[model samples]
Target: MEAIANGLILLMLSIGHAELWTSVINRTHALKIHEVYLKRLRHVLELLMVLFPLVLLFAVGLSDPGVLVGGEWSQLPLWWQPILLLCTLGFLGLIYSGVRHQFYRPPRQQTAQESELIHLRERLKQDLIGEGPYHYLAGLPFNEIFSVEFTRKTFQLSRLPEKWEGLTILHLSDLHFSGTLKREYFIELCRIAQEMKPDLIIFAGDLIDRMECLDWLQETLGPMQAPLGRFFILGNHDWNQESLQIRQTLSETGWIDLTAEPVRLQHEGQTLFMAGTEAPWMGKLQDVKLSEDNAADDFLLLVSHTPDNFHWAEREGYDLVLSGHTHGGQVRVPPFGPIFAPSLHGTRYTSGTFFRGSTLLHVSRGVSGIHPLRWFCRPEISLLTLHSADKK
Candidate 1:
């Protein structure tokens, strides 16, 4: 009984210590770390972490530690008693922190006015193209199936203008349309999105993966209908293809390219100023300067491919920002959230809605990825309804 108790306490301590160190690495180095090397290191660390407690138990048992051998408290070495007590307290503290973070933390409130059923056809087949042998060997091919979840989230802000109340915007991003994802999949997505009857449509870049899918854009994306208008910005992946051609194609399809310029529109008696910036990775982010004089009483909105611009948007007094790029970290782990997110802040701005001062940032998980495998992270198309908190 004594040995068993000691072993359990030691195990908890080991787990707590491992988690603390892992968090340090994830928060500090994950963004800068190389993918393959980081993955390999994480795997090796996990294996060693799990085996540590067992190895420690064996060593203590062989040495016949007084505490493990059921010796009286007073008979145990004075130093050993304090060490055990400290370890036990540290483990309990870790447990308390975990419980508090899980149940007591105040998460941002997200209210949904309505959500439509994600209609997936029964005959929709899973098709994997150009997938390497590693995918099949690792059972990742099963995760490559194209599916979408349509979410309608309402954001009520006290600062929101009453004239723009109940404004619905459809947000789409990261349509990594490589050969793996078929044209029909996007067509189905657009069909469902059109049914939402959004007042405006915003595409936050990474619309195409390769040049081969360029024709699919006009055939599938052209049919999307919106009452107000459609706007788009380029992402890192968009530059992989001919950026000029993509911009021209979008213009020809009646989609306004908001890159590097702010456009003003009158909607429902409200003045809306929508602007976009080139992705920071593309070296043209500086060109997207917004003029203070142009903002005149207009509801300012920005479209950025990466959430890294959230700070800039907030500093410039923008009310809302739509962005994508992290793809919700591609794979999310419960409680711990995303294991990796490609940003300077790591997983801080990976996905979902966030508030920076008065600026609200919505980061989409995206329509698709370079590789189709996604676990616990579903592809998303969001319908955002903006409401004035002051109205009610």
Candidate 2:
């Protein structure tokens, strides 16, 4: 019984250590850190997450430290003391985060959500980029990378304008375009987008991961259009590449650049605002002032590359906010949820619909990532339909 108890304690402590490091990694990704440096840091941290935990489990837990190291706990090496202290603190953090996860509840604005899974590989019948990077993992027994989830969510907003009772926006973000998933996958995704036939379309960010795949946009997102407009912003991944050229190409292809200032449009004879921010990567939150009288008609929609800006959008009185940077943690562990999300809030805003004050935030799971592996989390294309919950 003591051995089992000790093993459980060590396991929890190890999880705590990993989660604490995950927070560090998540916050670092939120900044403008170099990809190469961040990658190396992640590798080193991963090694430490394993090595440190194993050493403690074997040296202390198994041997019952007080017996092996002579009577008092302080008799152990000085280094071991700090390690033990950090482990205990990490376990506390794990318990706190776990409590938050357990109590997570969606806001009342989310009326309903429906999902459909599309199997691109079986449907296309042909090999989609045969033997791309990490092809073995792609074929893992239950890997969900290729299985796309087309989710349609309904948000009932009390502040919605009467003119736009039912407004649909197809939000597509984080199409990494790394050549790992192949061209057909993206083309098919675009085809489905066209079929949805939304009023407007928004590509949040991270359009191109590899510069070589820049031309692929012509066949994929280039042809996609909507009645209102198609707007886009560059993500950190795109910023790392030739962002100017990528922006130019996207602009030439018909998508409006929202990375600048807010754009005003006339829809249903009511004024609407569209804005984008790549904060902590490209720029900061935009400043805007709205007339109190026109609040009924002026609907502000902000596209942020990361959900970290959700609170900012809420405070700024945005009607809707769209984001996709964490990619639903790329891989999720059920019951415990996602372990590593690239946001300061850790895995809290990884993905899904969240409501804060008057703002409704939708974080997409995203199409793909730089590293091509998705276990329980499927890539998502969200179609958000906004309805007026205002009785007046």
Each candidate's TM vs. the true structure?
A: 0.72, 0.92
Residue lDDT tens for model 2, 1-392: 55566566667767778877877888898888978899999999888888877676667654645422333455567877676678778777766766766677768899988999998888898766534456566666787888899999899987678878778999999988877788988999999978999999999899887788999989999999899999998899998989999999999999899876678888877778878898878876754334345455688888899999899889988889999999998887766677788888888898888988889999999998877778889999988898989695
Candidate number with greatest lDDT: 2
Candidate 2 worst ten-residue window by lDDT? 64-73
**Model 1 spans with C-alpha error above 4 angstroms:** 1-109, 113-145, 283-286
- List model 1 lDDT by residue over 1-392, tens digit each: 77788656667766655544455445433233444555587687677667756664554433445446664445545666655565456455455544533453212534653544453434355443444223342235445245567888988765667877788999999987776656777777888788889999999998776777788777667888788899998887777567788878878898888974678888766678888976554545556656757645678899988888899889888888999988887776556556556565656677788887878899998887775767777788999998887543
- Each candidate structure's count of clashing pairs: 0, 0
In angstroms, the error of model 2 at 16 is 1.7
For model 2 the TM-score comes to 0.92
RMSD (Cα, Å) for all candidates, in order, is 5.7, 2.5
What does the lDDT read for residue 151 in candidate 2?
93
lDDT for model 1? 0.71
